[model samples]
Target chain A: MTASTAGTRLAIDASDLVKTYKGGVQAVRGVNLRIPAGTVFGLLGPNGAGKSTLVRMLTTLSAPTGGSASVAGFDIVRQQKQVRRAIGCVAQNSGVDVQATGRENLLLQGRVYGMRGVELNRRADELLLRFGLAEVGNRFVKTYSGGMKRKLDVALGLMHSPQVLFLDEPTTGLDPEARSEMWEQIRELAWDQGLTILLTTHYLEEADQLARNLAIVDQGRIVVEGTPDELKAQLNGDAVSLELAAGSDADTAKSIALEQGGVLSEIGVDGLTLRGRSADGAGAVPALLAALEAADIHVASVTVARPSLDDVYMRYTGRSFNAAEQAAAHAAKEEKK
Target chain B: MSALADTWYMTGRAFRAFLRQPMYVAFTLIQPMIWLLLFGQLFKSVTQLPGFGASNYETYLVPSIVVMSGFFGAGWGGMAILDDLTRGVLDRFLVSPVNRASLILGRLIVQVLSIVIQAIIILLFGAAVGASYHHLVMGVLVLMVATNLLATAIGALSYGLALLVRREESIIAASNFVLMPLQFMSTGFMALVLMPHWMQDITKFNPVNWTLVAGRGALGADPDWGPIFENLGYLAVLMVLCAWVSTRAFRSYQRSM
Candidate 1:
């Protein structure tokens, strides 16, 4: 179990991790990561960015192609049994057995981890209640709603009270309400249990809300990594938006706005909207107003807001997060075919 | 403490799931019963030939029915593997500290036990219709071992196929395409002498024929130890081969993922 004994702060550490599938599909290409204990670390990436593959490797489902990783101070490859003992994995696919009841699933999982007798039964019941699955614990999982099934999957993963918990796209196919509820549960698990969590998600808002620190991965590599506030602060300005009056010429308005004392960051012709970044939106707004007035462009409304994670992603990638996700998903489907 | 305690824990879950859907159990039992009642009646008069060893047709048919029920039940064992693969349940177990061999062994053990129970029921039905075992205890023991060995081999083979294809439809199609012909070609429904000389020669290599021979040896008035031991040996070898194949299939499935 070649693990770093340098203090106790690091929960998970990886260096130059590489995973290549058959036919030379480089799913994870030389990635490096470090996660602190008791923090919710988010691996932010679009579909096919190798998030699930990395999770699988770390959890010992698959071995890495190159480099090395350690989870909870145990080498992922050399001490796979210890790694398996220390980490709880809630995979992208629902792992619950639909033929078995919720309680049955948890009990089986607990027993697999070497828990038995009274301790196993107590843990199963406790998790059922904690995850809000007590009511349906005796019912077959086939009758469970999608949200309930996913929750039970998480509960099953948590049956052994592992030190590290891995959640791969925990709310990918969930409804909005269910997604929020899942987010809350994830937060509670980290806060209440002090469990180190590693989560992967395509949703920018989900990463922004839950992650204390995150890495943006694209095409099997990390593009950037930092706290959400630190990443957003990299934009270096307040974002100012001007909603032009109906039928206004957006191109002409954008040209006039660019001439003002701020940098024109974006121009949307469809909505006749103009966006600019500046140190002082209050002063820059008047200057932009004067410029637009001189250009004879009517403005319906104007507002300025702080730079968000989306703006930070746009600055780095030159594409909206959602657009990148769509492209990645399309590429994944094509590869499958 | 028990050799079968782990098997029980694992088999208990499968049985619970099986019991949850009573219709599935009914359907599983019905197919074998049809083969016993209908097929047995159709082939009754054929046993009048010399060296048939049984005076009554029911007596000769009972052992075949027991082996056939085991054959049919074991064919569907791979469905459980396919279901687990599709639902991500197998992945969950992979990451846990669960004994991997136990997972496959448990399912095979459950299917074998279920088939044995069904064989007992069929034996009782045969008795009611003028069938009787000369060595009843030894016959029951022989049937138990024969059914268990046959079911385990077939179940493991099916599990291997399930992992190879990783789809329910493919697993079902392959099992059906393979087992139905093998059952018909074996001595499960007829005496070896009743088959053509070429077919009789072919039956020598069929594991199902070995099961039928062993099962019948225990039930017949003239019990034959030589053929019974030979059949048991053949089945033991086949069981090892199928178990190895299934383990390799499981590894390949994990690698693909």
Candidate 2:
């Protein structure tokens, strides 16, 4: 298949990639992806959607069972050294040495990447300051907080000034505040350094905030691929939600909403609630209120908002974001067994 | 750059970590000291046996203890690999431009250096207890080379196994399983002539026995250069073979990952 070349030069290119575990379980099945330079490309997936597996292949950690991948213009298998030289990987698990001082860890990473003498020390100090880790650079990593360790992991990955950076779930277990800080750092790296970033995340808000373009992956394949705005625009309307009194007849409320030029999206049985999408939720609300009044349905509350990435994901996958995440976690556990 | 300079830089890191925990240093030396104190006295009268070469048991037993200590120390060398794997330090190195073989070689070199230091300490303790080297200077140099080679081979083998098993418990179990039998089967405790004919035949295949023979030749009153070279040759072959196998195991580990 002809790969897409719409943006800048490709930093990562994979075609028909496949990876199978030891017990004949296919972790990644015939996936293809292209990431352009100087853009943040988010790979959004439920836990076992082969996002990590794909990252591993692209980073040259593992060879694909079939098909091929190239990172920074080097074949992942045949030219693995060059691939490794060009790409930095902050893996899903924080790969920091807890016993070593944060500065020592970065220095060792620089040495391993062939940086030497004055240049290595200078770069290590630079990264420490850039990542706000200069104060803790001399402290052993075991004393570091979770966020600090994660920042160190990222710093280690970037010691060589790699062309492409693969951050696999950069904020998986962080608190809300830490997660936001991580997002901001990621954005700064992409914007300030012009580094091509491929980030994998299950958080819809994170993807929407950080990615210029994203691919929604599920069951080891790309389900949909587009910019976050483009994907949200696919819904093509504003979202309206209504909460009615108990026993107020949700069917009647949905019918009322449909008659008011809004498409009935969903209805909740317990609260007798209705949700819909429309070009103009404000204009549709009065007509819907009139219909509900004629039907004697007591509307307790109503809300209208722009279509969020959550709604877009639910619309495309027919599953709530949380439910999809739970399912993905379950699949990953089963695969591990 | 000189290879020694490269090896020293790598070895220095290991030594720094070793110095951080005095308890580990104490633990490493305690085992060899036990053999020196207890086993040396127990076999004090055994040196009266003909062709034993050494007039005193302490003199004979010290060299054996050094070789034994080196082997025992080498068995635990894989702990560094296991620790690195658990901490993701190995993966960090794998993703970099460093020489892949150097990663393993550097660690093994550090292990050998550490074992050599332990050997020197044991030798000094033996000298204090009235044990003397046969060809003083040559004996010291040969003992260092032989013990380092033996320890390096075992250490590299353990490292390769660490990559295969990828668990501390399993690596310890496998190292113990290999080490205990070799320690007993070799001439570490008793001379070859004192053992059964069957055991004597078996010692020919044991690398530990070769180390003991080489070390013993250096410490005896009448040093036999021929048997020393022969024993050194055996250990040299074992080192090459084990290193080759370990490299293969390392390659398999990378493939599996």
Candidate 3:
């Protein structure tokens, strides 16, 4: 990776990076990533999947226990100041000083990166205008709404015109409307500014919508890496969902569905709804219905759709994203007991 | 920009935030006035005792109370740092290429500024109540500088404790634990000769006593030049040591991250 020519150096490159905390908790375990210059990359995962820890290491806020990485072609460990100067990071928590005005915060951040006088003032104003915060730029952040505070956080990160911008869960706590607005701002930051962006998100839709290239992280490891469409295409099948009647037997229905010729895997049942994949959903529906009828299991309704990123996750992890999250939470609870 | 410039810029941010809280500043400033008025009158008769050097209680109480204000204000300075740590503002600065010393120093500078303002207010209030300085303007400036040094040193230690514990409750407990004992042991509220023999000996080592003695010499009828300069030097050395400890605590925090 280091042998790349000057013109095409990777914006961010990590090889076998690991981070084990003081109490033996391995937050990030040997994860590797290569993000191209001037592209948007996503790190997608559930709540406890180490996405935030990986960002911390990349941003130079925390040190990795093993291996090495570089940002903008500078070694993260040895040239940390250079790495910091080349990148901007908007962390998961809002980092804006609530008592200070937004413009003051930006000015201070710009100064921290060595900007001063006219250059700093101009950049701070430009960012406020760019993020649609110019009207309230001089008002104290304590008076701003949640969405406005988050916007100020992003604006502060961009105060130095960094080459690589890292947004960790940029829209995690926002409402639906604010989330879409934040998505627009992120897109403009990457597309118009030509900045390389490495975003971490737990929302699959956000990853699919904003990231051109993404890696699905689970349990401190990368489970899958590709463009969202490419990942979805890897599951070369249609998703077939069957809604069973209230008194229907789910085990018998699953066994019946498995007996059909085109059924790809075990049925996934969420309460009365059972789902499976098929090579050709339309053609397999008749045989699937006949098998269920033979077993005298009643089905209320049936529908088929193209495979989504959710299906892609299921195909790789053998469980849905929500189920995996719940199981992880339950296991953690039982461990505490 | 140079490191000094970065520290100044960061200090401006903290100073602006402090200005926004008018009510907080008002309360802190007013509390010292209440102590000076209430305690000065309550102990006015102490000046009539033999071996007391001052002609009036207000003259003697003014300088001590001014030093007390600085001590009290600087003691709780870490609450602001705790707020920054919880809100992620400190981490934002940590990720930047800014000088790490600036982060700690910038905060202490703000506390020193507040202490200076409080000292000035006390000075004005004392003059209104018939307290006159020994050397007038020059002596007033010395008192201000001495108070600033003491506040900066104590504020630095408060920030160090803030980073070490990172819990509001524990920081407050640690602050009171150190402050209450120091207040009882120091010569801030009384003259050295008035204290018991053992306490007078122990007060020789109290950092707060160094601040008070310097302040009293500046405002007394006849200023003692030697002990004032010596104690001011001690305050300067203590300020450097406290700033170093605060920076070390910051390093530990980054490593733990």
Clashing pairs in 1: none
Assess candidate 3 and give its lDDT. Answer: 0.86
Q: Comparing to the true complex, what docking class would candidate 1 get?
A: medium
Scored by lDDT, the top model is 3
What's the C-alpha lDDT at position A131 in model 3?
85
Report residue B29 deviation for candidate 1 (angstroms).
Answer: 3.6
What is the lDDT of every predicted structure here? 0.84, 0.81, 0.86
All candidates' TM-scores?
0.93, 0.92, 0.90
TM-score of 1: 0.93
Model 2 Cα RMSD, 1 decimal: 3.5
lDDT of 3 by residue, A27-109 (tens): 89999999999999999888788999999999999999998999898889998888888889999999999888889889888
Q: Cα deviation of B165 in candidate 3 (Å)? A: 1.0
True contacts kept of 3: 0.90
Assign candidate 3 its CAPRI class. high
TM-score attained by model 2 = 0.92
DockQ agreement of candidate 1 with the native complex: 0.72
Where does candidate 2 stray beyond 4 Å? A1-8, A236-239, A262-271, A315-321, A327-337, B1-12, B42-54
Worst 10 residues of 2 chain B by lDDT: B1-10
State which candidate, 1 or 3, has the greater DockQ: 3
Cα lDDT tens digits, model 2, B1-257, are 33444344455556666666788888777777878999888878777878655577777788788888888888988888888777777777677656667777777766776787888888888888887777878888888788878988998888888888888898778877888889889877676788889999999988888887787777667778998999898888888998998999878877776
* lDDT over C-alpha atoms for residue A46 of model 2: 79
